[model samples]
Target: MEVCFVVGRNGAGKSQYLIDQAKGNNQDSLYLCNTVHDRSQELKTSKRFSVKNTGSHPNNVMKSVIKKMMREGTHRLHQIEKILLYCGYASHITVTMRAGKIDSRLDDFSDTSSIKKLTEMIDNYFNGEDEISFNVNFGETSDISSLSKLENLLHQEKPLRHYGMVKAIEISLYKNNGEPVPLLNASSGELSLMTSLIFVLGEISGTNMILIDEPENSLHPRWQREYTSMLCSLIEYHEVKVIIATHSPLIVTGAQLDERVSSSIYHPATGNLEFSSSTNIEELLWGQFEIISPKSRFLSEKLAEKLEELSAHKVSLNQSIEFIDSASKASFDDGQQDIFIAARQLADSIARG
Candidate 1:
């Protein structure tokens, strides 16, 4: 299981490349998306193709192609390799694309007794009228439109019992009377946390490679740290291959806070993959108070502009103030103010030269 992150700017062709790889070589590929009607998740919606030599016939809907895939066969060895594609999809569907291959038939995937039990389970769930409810422990919302109340809620010390679009979830756990909790009660960050926690726990238990993209999207900086810590713990305990893609500075900062995470982010630049940061990048990113430091390439251009301005023969107090303000805003470290002060004091030297 080789887990890797492929990151680039939007429209960088990264997702298309990954899709092609999944299409070319995979028994099953699961694509989970949060948005409905997203074009990215558009793949084979039906399982048939048609052509006409010449005729007035409009063509058929190809329901048989779809039905064949839906119909399960009997042998484990003869079982069709499934490609599970999902987008804004809660239900799972498996598909197989074979080119007139007749050997792809099944007759013994399970024993008669096992098949009977499976059939019973499916029929009972799908055809039966009776239902069973599970107990859910979500609390009620007190403030729906009060800003002050919402602000105060944000200050809560403990994690919400069940948060973020939770009420909207298909929770088996419900009240005795069967009313579920409402989704509005949870904040975006709370929902993000809940989803991450559930996903890490529920899925990826037996996955070959687990991939998370821009996981810091809806999370607060603090929760980013918390989630990173939780992920580290899970990866260690499970010994699974994990890869995360993020453009958040907070994610990098969070990983730097922990001693266990070692992988770095790689981004595609000009069709060549560039290493944005290894484990060593952050340690060297914020170091050195001096602008002349070798690692301070990003700040070098700004520093040069400041220095060139100071070397002129006509400088003033107002100019000094503006320079200091700009430098402070573009600060690399604590010594930023000191550099501005140095320029201010040397105004006479600059004016003389």
Candidate 2:
């Protein structure tokens, strides 16, 4: 369970790094990316799988299943049921809903037959006895040990509910008291955590390598701090190597704590990759990650210069205040405003002493 992290700014070839790693290990790699453009085209022999493409295709197998179901006449609910059946093998099974088509096709079922049928189909597909079973095998044959391992991994987290009868196959988290809430209703951090975990647990097995681009997307600082631990738990259960691309300092800090995890910082300007062991978020940000804004960096340098000059001379209180005020105003970046203000207060205190 080796975990290697790639940290860099946007356009630093982080995605390409994953692609290169995947290509090098072609036969056993799985790429899960969120980019709009298909990066899978670059993979000569590796496999690409994402939430969008998982079990979503009109292949011969699916077409045959749909054709057999459609022979029972044009019932919209029946069509949806067949699609779910085809996707049943996937861990993240879902049905696609087009409102215009639904309104047009099910117009005849005005007595709410459409709603009833849709509900019934969802219940049958997901709520049945075998629906929650982790018997799926991406390549290796399913075994009792593997199924138990997956089941235990899923159970360790909050149970997720399937919003199967709606627009698409959506997942919702269960509240402490066992009430299910929609994914939209959850906080951005919670959603990010759940989505990443599910994606890993659902696809990690049966693959030799897992590549994730920006696992920190939509995560809060606290959630970002926990991301690596969550990832490590999943990786521990499988014989897989994981590579992640991220810009989060929390993730870098998390990587520093684990000896099994390796961290690499990509410098876009120099086109170089360097190993990082810094646990301080500021060092990770300004040094390795280079995430500082130009405006902020300039203002910080100016403030430091002013402070050094003040320390060397007995500047008047009025002069010190004036310098601080001018520097504060010059620091136009919102993120650095607080730092400038703090520097001003410190300067004022020194002048008074």
Candidate 3:
């Protein structure tokens, strides 16, 4: 799989470029974008091109994936676990068979007993239920059995289906301490990123081109740093080309470490695309994104004004340097205090002149 990152600022036409790619490409493609109701409905009508409206109510996507898992099989266990681990907000997960109220935690089943507790529970209580619903809960100690293991253990009494038919699913979340985390809270950047992966892994395959716009949206700085690599690791085996659009420097750094990944910068003003060959984050941020000063913009602006004051003799060079030093210790500097060092150099140059 080839992963290309489209790096640019907001209003850069990155999303529009993705839409155009889907429209122009002959191959089957999936465009994942922010949901604009009328726009999404119109795009959904295309046959070869599939559109997923994300960003607005992303939990709906996860609910659909969970329901699909219940209907199909539990083979997606590894994928689900990986997402939970990556998100780091929860430690474990519980999936309840909502209709039958059957909770299958593998720990509840013992090796000494030939039959598991869940199978016994189903046989004794949930038999003859026509429809089943699975409720997913995070942070609960739920060691769900794999489909094969469950089938082997349950087959002694009856086929797994004899208990109930798969129908619907509800998803819940919690903190590591087992306190419930609201569903709305779970629909954060972590969930958004996980939802994108689940959507792609669950539905996309077979040489499809995947277009994901701003996967870094609302992600923490740490998550942004890990997002690209995490995504590439999951989808590497699939025969697909992925194009992700983002303005995050942390995301750009991830692509730099991977040899297989490629990137380009979209100049929204000129409508030009520049292929990015540099592996350095500083260079990429400055050269490609035109972010000449990758420092706190407010701090940078303040420093610039102070430099102007120094040039105008309103402040001495030492006073300017002291000002820079003071600003360096100030809050909202965003770890780019090195701007002070540069300002000190400029002040020294002014003094020499």
Candidate 4:
């Protein structure tokens, strides 16, 4: 499997790159864009699934899973079950007061009929009923023993035990306090992660390429670090190539930490994507992505010059103090000002020594 990590700032043509690659690739491909809504129409591929359409509707996603299972066979049922457990599916109908009148909307996507069918299938298979069979021509035969083992593992992980409850006509995920949290009510990060994983794993097979834009969006720093490794593992399982475009340093560094995956940065100024050997986040920010703002860059250069002068003994202590004071006088925003202040203190200490 070929795994490529593309890191760059906004408007670095990351999305365009993925689009072009998907268009050019002769083999089957799946393009998942978190930023764009309903891009599947523009991309003109049934294999491509975006968060906008599919992520909002859990019933629709479950329906897709059932269809895939029918076509691909029951061997993948464990993966399907895992995704279903993680994805938030229950939604509550809500009402609002407007001008002394009531306005109500139904946010729930639960299809009782479909849920019943899915639950029946699961129950029959797990109960070791010989009447049910989900084998198809897609590939391997159904592995009930392996599926049983995975089901046990998933149960042990506590995600299923903690978050999910499966029923004959309904399945709902609850929060730690035992209140049900629907997908729509779930955090943006959680929704994105679950939806992306579902679509990717559901349609990964028989495809040579996968293009994902900004998978790190709305994810926590820890999740961002694990994002690349997770995708690489999935890609390897499917035996497909994947191109990921992201702005997160954690995502880039995470890929670097994984020896199995390859990482690169797209330099917008140079119009080239180059392999990055430097693991330093500072080097990545400045050299590869050019993420430093002009004002911050100016301040950084000024601080470096002042520190150099102090080290070389080319300026008096008083002069160095004056320089530092003048530099700090410049108005800077929160992070930039903090950096300038730290630089001033460091330079002051060096000059005094």
Using TM-score, give the best candidate's number. Answer: 3
* Arranged by lDDT, best first: 3, 4, 2, 1
RMSD of each: 17.3, 13.3, 10.3, 12.0
Query: What TM-score would each prediction reach against the true structure?
Result: 0.44, 0.49, 0.60, 0.58
- Per-residue C-alpha lDDT of model 3 across residues 27-97, encoded as one tens digit per residue: 76766653331232344422221224432344556555554554565655456666766776464443333
lDDT, candidate 3, equals 0.57
As for candidate 1, its clashing pairs are 74-108, 74-109, 75-107, 75-108, 75-109, 76-109
Candidate 1: C-alpha lDDT? 0.37
lDDT of 2 by residue, 113-208 (tens): 645655454454344432333323222234545334333323322212222223332233344454555435666555445444444444444678
Cα lDDT tens digits for candidate 1, 1-353:
22344455566654454444445533333232222222334434211111111110111111122222223211211111111000011112111111111121223543556444433442443244332222211122222233222222222201111211011112221223434333223355544444343334433334444445456666776666555665666455565544454454555555645666654444444444333443234422332111122233444445445556666524454665575566456454675567656655665455566
CA shift of 59, model 1, Å: 40
Model with the higher lDDT, candidate 2 or 4:
4
lDDT, candidate 2, at 14: 80
lDDT of each: 0.37, 0.51, 0.57, 0.57
lDDT for model 2 = 0.51
Model 4 agreement with the true structure over 221-287: per-residue lDDT tens digits: 8778878787676556566777887777667766766888766666544566667564343456544
